[model samples]
Target chain A: MSVLDEVLSANEAYAASFDKGGLALPPARGFAILTCMDARLDPAKYAGLSEGDAHVIRNAGGRASDDAIRSLVISYKLLGTSEWFVIHHTDCGMEFFTDEVITGLLANSLETAALGDDGFYDVGTGPGSDHGQHIDWLTISDQTQAVVDDVVRIKEHPLVPPRIPVHGFLYDVRTGRLIEVPVPSDESAA
Target chain B: MSVLDEVLSANEAYAASFDKGGLALPPARGFAILTCMDARLDPAKYAGLSEGDAHVIRNAGGRASDDAIRSLVISYKLLGTSEWFVIHHTDCGMEFFTDEVITGLLANSLETAALGDDGFYDVGTGPGSDHGQHIDWLTISDQTQAVVDDVVRIKEHPLVPPRIPVHGFLYDVRTGRLIEVPVPSDESAA
Candidate 1:
């Protein structure tokens, strides 16, 4: 069966046993979390959030990029979220490659797919041409630094309320332990 | 207790019983899901995804913007994920406001916070100033159309392999039903 089919079947079971239906519009905990899209970091399970607790905004590296800021603005301005948690995990896939390497792979894939030869379907090859120009992969060389940078970005954002505390964290994929990264306290912040 | 404290306490409890420890780097299901950051949409329960099943990339409206594309490229090129599921939900918060409305609220909040008066904190107000310039907000007037547009964006991305299937779906928040949205088939895609 296809993966979609499996999920659909699972959804059927979930619907049948669904009980948590009346959650409020805004997050119950008055916070939003920005984290990596790693399957291992189950926000609800690891973060101890039940249904309707918090808004979990996830991307590849969990970098507080422009997209993350946009979401945070909505989370605070409209959805009543006050706190921001920027969590980047240890041993992230993003740490493994640079922007150029990834874009090169993509370019190669496109070129090979155009050729339409099944034999040429090799995911791994020698260094590919640099197609990742100007794309900040946001690849994590240092996990703690990445998280701290994101926290600062949130704290400094004009749209993000100065009252909202932005916390940075690092989750170890192997041990499943969450370590709090210390960010410089913004004295000027409300 | 603060929400973070509550969650940290929960995380401790979760770690005590955590058993899904050693899942691999890549998703086992070879797929990734793009969806909203709504608390109600528990991907594991509703989509039948377990730990290490799929990379769930979430944001405000689940729009396939540049950041989403960056993540998708990583998921496909670095990770083994092959399929893409763009799932937008019913009763999304995005449908409630435009970019201007949200940005205006933010501006008002910043102004109020600057005033340093707790009594001035009012969430209910009409017609906020335009604080959301250059921010797409990815606001959804129509949920289905938004999903379709995101799916198309993913399909048309240069980095995304044309061979990979991009499916769009609408998830009902109240009833927990997953409805598939029809996307035009790309006959040229592998």
Candidate 2:
């Protein structure tokens, strides 16, 4: 069976015992989490969120990209969330390659790249686009710094309110732990 | 306790028993899922995903915004995901308002809005920005259509490989079921 079929069948079991249908549109916990799309980091599990608990915005590196900020803005401005967390994880795929490297790979071909001991190398032939060159890819060199940068970016965004406290953390995929990344005291104070 | 403190406490328990430290960086399931930031939808639970199972990109409405496409591109181009799913859920907060309404609310005040019988209304005083006016917000008028649109957008993206199949599904928030949103046969065939 396809992964889609498998998940659909799983959903059947999930729905069989589903009872939390009346959750309010607004997050009951009054918070939002911005994190990576990495499959290993389950925001609901790590963050202890139940249905109707919080909004979770995720992307490549969980960076504070414009789209992510837009989601955060809506999460608070419209959905009544008062707090936010920006989480990036250890062993994140984003940290494995830079924008130039990924773009170079994409420019070669749109097929999957193989990761050897050294790093990723393209395996496909022909039919590639330079479109990836235009994207930042939000690659991460430092996990803690990436989390801090995202937190600061979200905290400093024009659309984000000063009242909301944004926290930064790194989730350890191995141990399933969230380690806080401290923003500068002055920055947090300001 | 603050939500942060509470979640951290919960994390201790999750970490204590965590034994999946050996999972690889790339998703083992060889697929990706783009879904909404809705608090009610647990993509892991609904999709039956374990650690390192699949890439899951999420945003306000799970709409295929450029950033989402960027993540999906990286998911396939770099990580080897062969299939993708665009899963938007029922009763999403994005369906509660239009782009204009959200930007209008943001323009009035950057504080949290209240949801009453009429819909969202700003209750905070002063200091708002028109920055939101520039954002797309990607609000949903119809859930199934949004899923179909996202799937089509991902499939037709310049960076996405044509060989990868993108599936569209609407997750019923009430039942925890994923109902397939059939793409027009020609669209999928193309």
Candidate 3:
């Protein structure tokens, strides 16, 4: 079965575990998670969550910026979210890349978009051939300070309530388990 | 109340609602998503997902290259998932960036850790920034195409299964309503 198929199959089994739940289904007795779009990793296997329980959001390195925070504001204020889970893993591509390069490239490319080299840019098949090589700056190989910083960013974020719990976890690509990192509580002076 | 306070308060109510379900344990839920690191967009409110339901993930237009995909696969497969939601808003920032400038800038700055400035480098934030961007080529602005392509990619992915049922959505920042995009039964056709 393909990755989607396995998830579906697992979802069926997972859903079967709790068809009609207590009260109103706990809203997110199931959840929607936002993580990176990396192909080699599997979420349900790592986060200890299963199908029929959560929603998964995959983007790059699962970074929570103004935009994602905006969505979080909505997901909680309007959607009824209770907990916050942010996972930044080891050997992440996010570690190696940089913003200036990306945005700058766009600015340059757009400036020259209408013209090839100088006009009619090639939007199709970008940069290199591998399509697999991640920018070095984008990759976060270690799971320490980065995870803490992200968690702190989430917890202290003015957008989120100081008390709204935000967690930081590490999903070891090789092992497929999300290890929760020790983060200072939102109330911590440090 | 701050965004977190607002969410926590609502979570208290949401959690109270859960008490009747017998799970009765929490004052809050999980995960708040910050995307793009782009301030102009909203993912959940626009995607139609209920508030307090799930965390949001934002980066460069929600592209799931091998790196991001690997993390998601694990988050879903192991952590547990039932819904896989994509909240790509109109006029995304991913539409503005590229791989060239990203690689070039990084290699020049960290010139030592060169991944070759001329290839398919994924640009993003500097070390510890956790701000991730995307490769210009793989990301698409067309909602229909992006959604269909993502769903198909997730569904047909060799690593995932067919039954996973990936869903696509467009969030209109103006409307604040999650517009569900239709995925062709076989969106992979294109």
Candidate 4:
């Protein structure tokens, strides 16, 4: 059976015993969290959020990119979220590649790269071949700086209100501890 | 104290007891989940996932936009994730407004729209004013179709390998139940 079948089966049991069905559409806590897609780092458990608490947006590196900002705008504007959290975790796969080098990595088969760059060969059939859909992986060598930059991006974006407080954190995936990354003072900090 | 300060304080206690710090970079299960930003629906719990299991990519409505595709590309090519799961939920705020109407709603203040659009007044200072940063919220009038279309998009994307199996689910946020949305027998399901 496929892994999805397993999840669906699990959902059957979850639904059987489910009780919290009437939570409001908007998050109860009036905030949104942008965090990595790492499975070990369960954002809800570590963040002290219960059902209906806050919006949790996860991506590969949790780097508040354009799409993330788009979501943040909706979270705050349409969904009533006021605060935003950007959380990047330690020992992330993001540290494995530099943003520039990842373009080559995105082209070649994982099988080719898994052994190391020695065997790297582009399929040329993938999205990398299409110049229009190309995207930077945004991998990071210095995660602290990345988190700080993403927080600043959200803070400075005109779409984000000045009243909204954006905070950045580096999460230790192994220990489940979060260390706050201080944002640099700028016009947006005002 | 701010909710973030509270979270940081809680993290101190969590870090004191931290143990699992050795999990590898690639997801142990070799899959990724695309879902909404709802707080009430914890992806790990509902999806029967534990730490270090699967990558979870989330955005406003879990729509498979260019940014989402970018993350999925990275998840599969660089991180060894093969399967993709798109899970949208019921009672979603996405159902509250259309994509075009949301641009107008994205302006000025949240309290103004939280009450209703009748009170909505554009601030003329936000991203709504910037024609370039404007993003279609990808709002959905029919979510089930949205999930199926998103799944098809992933399956057809050049970056996503043909062998990768993509599945769609409509999660009932109220009941914590996930109903599988089967891919239509057409272009990408081969």
* Candidate number achieving the greatest DockQ relative to the actual structure: 2
Q: What are the runs in model 3 whose C-alpha is more than 4 Å off?
A: A1-26, A30-34, A100-142, A185-190, B1-190
- Model 1 pairs in collision: none
Please give the range of 10 consecutive residues that has the lowest summed lDDT in model 1 chain A.
Answer: A112-121
Error of 4 at B35 (Å): 0.3
What is residue A77's positional error in candidate 2, in angstroms? 1.0
What does candidate 4's lDDT look like per residue over B1-190, in tens digits? 7887777776776667767688776788888999998777888878888778898999988989887887887777767787889999887777777655665555433332554467443443433444322577688888889898899888777666677788888888778888888877784554
Which one wins by TM-score: 1 or 2? 2
TM-score between predicted and true chain B, model 1:
0.85
For candidate 1, the lDDT comes to 0.76
Predicted candidate 1 versus true structure: per-residue lDDT over A1-190, tens digit per residue: 9887887888888888877767766787888899999877788888877767789889999989899888887777766787878999987877776665556566555432121145232444433335456577888887778887788877877666567788888987777778899986652243
Off by over 4 Å in 4: A110-112, A115-133, B107-112, B117-133, B187-189
Better of 1 and 4 by DockQ: 4
User: Which candidate has the top score in lDDT?
Assistant: 2
What's the lDDT of the predicted structure labeled candidate 4?
Answer: 0.77
DockQ of each: 0.46, 0.83, 0.04, 0.59
CAPRI verdict (incorrect, acceptable, medium, high) for model 3: incorrect
Distance from true location, Cα of A68 in model 2, Å: 0.9
lDDT of 3 by residue, A1-190 (tens): 5433432343344334433322221124323345654433334434434222443445556665444454454334323455666776655645543443333333332121121344232332223122122332233445577667666765665445554567666655544445667786553323
Candidate 3 chain A — worst ten consecutive residues by lDDT sum? A107-116
Identify the superior model by DockQ, candidate 3 or candidate 4: 4
Q: Least accurate stretch of 10 residues (summed lDDT) in model 4 chain B?
A: B124-133
